[model samples]
Target chain A: MSVAEKLIALDPLALRADFPILAERIHSKPLAYLDNAATAQKPQAVIDAVTEYYTHMNANVHRGVHQLSERATAAYEGAREKLARFVNAASPREVVFTRGTTEAINLVAQSFVRPKLKPGDEVLVSTMEHHSNIVPWQLVCEQTGAKLVAAPINERGELLLDEFEKLINERTRFIGIVHVSNALGTVNPVRKIIDMAHARGIAVLVDGAQAVPHARVDVQVLDADFYALSGHKMYAPTGIGALIAKAEHLEAMPPWQGGGEMIRMVRFDRSIWNDIPHKFEAGTPNIAGAAGLGAAIDYLEAVGMDRIAAYEAELLDWATRRLEQVAGLRIVGTARDKAGVISFMLDGVHPHDIGTIVDTHGVAIRTGHHCAMPVMEFFNVPATARASIAFYNTREDIERLAAALEDCRRMLA
Target chain B: MDLKDLYQDLIVDHNRRPRNFRRMPDANRVAEGFNPLCGDKLTLYLKLDGGTISDVSFEGSGCAISVASASLLTERLKGATVEEAEALFADMIPLLTGKLPENAPREHFRKLAALEGVKEYPSRVKCASLSWHTLEAALKNAGQPVTTE
Candidate 1:
């Protein structure tokens, strides 16, 4: 990347206009929707794509021989191709449609890892993973007598690479790590982690639910065995996400769910599974959601991920410096490499109270453990108010958030 | 809704210096409560003498609404009978949920009305009512933990 390219910033006004809900008023104040980590607001293109699907082609996919079925199937599978290309996958056959990242990780845990696990085997994850990443592995471990070990992290929320390398051993079978911490906004050194695991011939699953929207991900470059992501986090519809895996792993694993779409033939005594991607997709899939996701990928590509990543890095640097000026305010997760998230707490205020006070000024920030309870426990805070940035957010939105905090401290703290 | 309505002076005062903010060693009944949404927690302790409630206290951490609600309830219910406390808890529910009957007597919710502002923010109502729920749980069954969910 060139230095001039690094200095380029996206036009915030134009980007914000693409999202209709950004103009909404909360409590008669302009909505400063900063809760991007919870879920991102959709662009009009994605909304229109879903509406167009239901309006014109409302039919079950891959079932009927009629014209509508072909159109629906084309739209759905086209989304798979778009997503596969988005992550630079080897082929669309490796992409398996699931409800979201949770189901994607669970499919890999039960289908791929469960069959390979023996008693006393270990599946390693980091201390900063969302509950989605941790709980699925724990469920699989409980059934197979495998142990779940978490690699430690520092106060800065960066993963301890030395400690993580020490934990890898002959008994370790799999590694699940988050590409970015939702609670802390710390982007993990996943490339190094993947190389470490691959050196031991172990499969690694990267939880890309938080990473894909912020930056470009190339599965071939990282050589990750599996990558899971949520569409809603990437400006697509909810209940639509995908698991992109290596072809060897996908073909070798059995189907975790059994139903109509995943079957080649079902006899009374025996059943043959379908091909690589379809083998995991059970029952009728979310067709309209797939159309919306395809449109979301189109919108993101046209905007350019490099431009978004650079703009957000500048925005995060600005927010961190601005927030540090507030009295008695502490910013958690000061990783050297962070995305556009800033989790913070006031000296004497609880996060819930801070959340309420900010909402009165029409700033929407998430206040909770963010489904990363272990990270919160590590920091010794019950919760933190998180302001996650996206391409559409601007300086004015962040100003409203900081001002609301100042008022809250004066009134309560 | 205005921030002042929810975070009144009285609520902030009670939260700053919570009354009886310690575990009771001699209490015969205890119940722990958790509000998962906000990570607020409270443990209510009770001492019953014969058929009357002799003492009430709580120890925990929460937002201004929950802490104030618990402190105010302790002040109101320290000398009341167990049956009276249960009746008060039952009557206060409608007010907290913003469904109080038009002609209902004021005595049922007069002392607990500081928490009525929570009804405007439906999500925070769980925070304010969690302490009372724990009290009811402590009275009906002594040791089981409670969660607002």
Candidate 2:
């Protein structure tokens, strides 16, 4: 049997009980949530972690001397360690907490890359990047007089590696690429891209927002200079994410934001910055969010990322096959190596109409540019209906989606 | 909300083959409407002759609700006076928003009542009213593009 078949042979539905929201009904029908790329539904373990932190151990971290403060500090720092291990970073000191993937990229753009950029320095990025990766570099380029260059992608939404290498001249100082596209589910060859950039001494940053939830990520193996991921996308709470960078880069980069916790000593004249990760994380961080992320990591490890990856792969294969059976439905992206996302357009139907029709059937899917307008432009489509799968999703969800789509076709006809 | 209510036969037919869905070459007033949320976009054209709408048309792509609303608007405003069009706009807002009283007279919105189903879906209100909003902009001769936020 194939890997997908073997994984599906096992009962994956047993794991669905962990997420309470999945059991809830929508429009009197069982909710078929296919919007995992936008944000995943949090598990009860993560929810309990946040509530437990706020209920029993609630205090500011890093400066408190009381018992509760110590406990909170341990939990927060413990989460940092858990995340560092989750991504296989060299050390927890290399992990810096931020608001989300957007903030993490912005921090790197402003703190690490901005100071070194010159008037004509170029930053290379792919056309498939999410706005979080593109906009931060654009803002930094605007401020620093640097140029932002985009590499081309093929009709299948796969990045053209040869064209990307051709664009890499001496002026290219940084390369920002997404690990997996949220719009097309294309898993770009990030390790190869990073190695190509590193060969020329160009620092590479990988936006792992859509990646960490689907597959295993090893920053050390990939040798990526910087990798950013959002906790919310990985079944954790919102408003928390991490940026994992090399120790040398983190040490060399200046602090982006300044506040209480980031300073060693503050005076009217000058202030000494804190060391490493703490230096980058300014102000009072999201302690409960960190606890929740830690719990999320624990949950993922318990279920095994390898199993989740296999199960989701099976789910994606099932969904792709079922969706292909629908007439007049054209999938936007067909990369050879895709994750769990499938973006498609129905005959003479706008994505919004499709979304509304399916929503009445209790099927949830994302519709629109998906924050990747450049991808939309490249595909020559105004919008597309996307169904992104998670491990908890089943073949029945895909069936529901197909049925709802058929209903939409008949009604719109 | 029932899907049948939202996707009525009239709305779907109008969406498939919208009426007056073309550009007016000698139009004096034109305004474009865009809803960035769902990528619904359209440009409305109006030819006013002595304070009365002589010709009305629109050209763009949008959802079923948006296209149907725009098509219905063109048909309703074909020979309407500027004052009558303005009054229709005032009547349309309450119907889409469910703010009209139970006894409120809707004779002015006769054929346009097909859009009252939008009141059930709060998020879709912007789609049903985008063309109407753009019509208001065209009537004012506002050069700026209208966006339904």
Candidate 3:
């Protein structure tokens, strides 16, 4: 193996040691966590960052002239700058912190698309979006007389780019698409999609919840109008995320939530809104979570996103090859371009049963529709077992997953 | 945490070849059960002869525990009255929830004892009881479809 490759995940102890949960034992066996697509386990840096924030700097942000408040506000706002830099945003003014990807999408749906939509207007999305991406747009479409259109995917779980292009029309007001499908791991050609939408003057919101963790995303390079990301999916604490939008989009969007911190001044009849980012942040935010997210960003940058991607790609290839050799195991998604996720079904065995069986061996994987029911229906199955890999995962973890599946097959199939 | 405890031989056998796995087209009562967590869905049909469950059957897709529990329910509830079926379902809940009295008669759960291991897998307790909940909803004539969200 090359020196760079050896220095990465192949040097498993160095990277794996950073995550405290890697040493955990389940059912008298070493835990093999392959559920990165759902939520990633935090490293010590992230956990310590959260602890540092709460222990030393605990105060409500944007409030008192007190020292703690200033420190807390500095940390909170510093996290926003870090998020902007992570996505290569033009300015920190474009990044708005929210609860997570769900809230981020909902904010765009309510504040951006709802006003622009009219009767007979359409909002476009892919067939493989999480419920969070689909349901929010559906709610906005329902409120207005607008329609929601989903572009289809092929047997390989790849989006039909030509079909997606054909669906865009003059009446298509907005497009919401997932950058990486959590269920299938298909990384959509987001740049091409964004270009197509921009050609017709339609804005697109890229659900980057699954993308930001595994790959480097440059908003400036992709020219994405809006990008929604979840902190928990990227080894940060839960209840914290950011929506990176164009400065023009943020400036034009009406504040969806009106509360304590979102206004410049409140009047009896009307309330004046604050600036670009803070106008959208209404309540006392998850400041500690954001600080932890900043720490996670530091950790990833220290390791380098390019190296992480290369290491995970190798691990994913190893896992796919290992799982394919097992008898009666069928992989569901086989897109030409994919991230570090594999969804498969074993003959005569339900995904839930496989999940339970694997848990006995301390191999943790996700088994379900993965919040993409439409994708499951298209595959003609109820659910599939998903083993999503990360840079910290070793080859032994994949072997344990394969062995556990064979045991499941022996018991049930 | 043993795999055999959850996927016992009887559960595997029934899931492979479920009994009365068909739709009763002319049944008087019917209910659809859905577990949104794992997308296990089942449609239960009943042929009631004046409050007596003259016939019971289920048609749907699910895991071993779900399919086996439904198959066993159909096998045991045949020829039972509505009250008797409800009482048996009531008796099955404790087995799933780990609330069964230690001194309770062991004879009561002859076939259903296979599902007792579900108490160990808390996330899957709904899989073992999806059908029974659907049966309860059907008995009560709940117009809405039952869901273990």
Q: Tens digits of per-residue lDDT for model 3 on A1-413?
A: 43244465458567777899999999999999999999999999999999999999999999999999999999999999998999999999999999999999999999999999899999999999999999999999999999999999999999999999999999999999999999999999999999999999999999999999998999999999999999999999999999999999999989999898999999999989999899999989999999999999988887788888888888888889999998999999999899989999999899999998898899999999999999999999999999998888989999999899899888988
Which of candidates 1 and 3 reaches a greater lDDT? 3
Worst 10 residues of 1 chain A by lDDT: A1-10
lDDT per model, in order?
0.91, 0.93, 0.93
Candidate number with the higher DockQ (1 or 2): 2
Error of 2 at A248 (Å): 0.9
Residue-level lDDT tens digits of model 1 in A314-408 = 99999999988889799999999999789998988889999999999999999989999999999988889999999888888888888999998
Can you tell me which runs of candidate 2 are displaced by over 4 Å? A1-9
* Docking verdict class for candidate 3: high
**lDDT, residue A264, model 3:** 92
Taking the tens digit of each residue's C-alpha lDDT, what string does model 3 give over B12-97?
99999999999998999999999999989999999999979999999999999999999999998888899988887898888898
Instruction: Show where candidate 3 strays beyond 4 Å.
Output: A1-10
Candidate 2 backbone collisions, by pair: none
DockQ of 3: 0.88
Residue-pair clashes per prediction, in order, are 0, 0, 0
Identify the candidate with maximal DockQ.
Answer: 3
